[model samples]
Target: MKLSEIKEILATAEGVNFKLENGISVPAHFHVTEVGIITRDFIDCGGTVRHEKVANLQLWDADDHEHRLKAGKLLHIISLSEKVLGMEDLEIEVEYQAETIGKYDLGFDGENFLLLTKKTACLAMDNCGIPAEKQKVEMVNLASASTCTPGGGCC
Candidate 1:
């Protein structure tokens, strides 16, 4: 989700909640410890230069079990980051602690925010010589019986 969309959602929401793709919820007492803009510049396997920017939100769980981040508070934090860091309407990437720190793409499912699992993909598939998917056809649809009959001169 984009930063603007998140801000809009925060405006009407009461509590902030994040759920993993597997139906597991981030602890209610989580804290958004950091908010910033991340920029990535690199070269793909095809030697093409590329750049990406994303708004980052780092969630941390502390011993303070009573702490809960309200939607308004999170929105305030985002506003401050935007003002000071000059952040744009970039996609939001959330970093939260599981067994270790994991990064996720942010999404909303009407009722709650979802933390989607991230995956690595090859941007230069053609350059890397990956074969294109082949089309499949049924044997029965291959040819007409009149075109290739048993013991016929055509066959």
Candidate 2:
């Protein structure tokens, strides 16, 4: 999902909830610690220059179990970030602590926000040395096929 989408969702959302792709819910008391733009500029292995930008929302499971980040409050923070930082309506990326700080793409499933896992891919697959994936075809045995005959079961 994108920044604008979330802002719209927050307008009527009764509660703010986030869940991992695996169905594990983020703690209710979790806090959105940061909202900022993340920009990446780099050269790929295929020697192509690339750039990326996203609106980042970092979640922190705070010790204050009583604290629940309300939808309106989050909207306020987002509104401030936009006005103060001049943030763009870029795709949303979420940073949450798992075993380490895991970066995820944002999604919404009608009722809950989803933190989808991110995967790396060769940006210039055609230029990269890695071979393209081969088409898979299931093999069937024709060796046991019946032969045409007048009255044989082999037919």
The TM-scores of all predictions, comma-separated, are 0.89, 0.89
Residues 1-155 of candidate 1 have per-residue lDDT tens digits of 99999999999997899899999988899889999998999999999999999999998988889998999999999999999999999999999988999999999997789999999989998898888889996677435657777677774
- Candidate 2: residue 37 lDDT (0-100): 93
In model 1, how large is the Cα lDDT of residue 145? Answer: 51
Q: Report model 1's TM-score to 2 decimal places.
A: 0.89
Enumerate residue pairs that collide in model 1. none
Top-scoring candidate (lDDT): 2
- Runs in model 1 lying further than 4 Å from the true structure: 139-155
Instruction: Please give the distance, in angstroms, between residue 152's alpha carbon in candidate 1 and its true position after superposition.
Output: 8.3
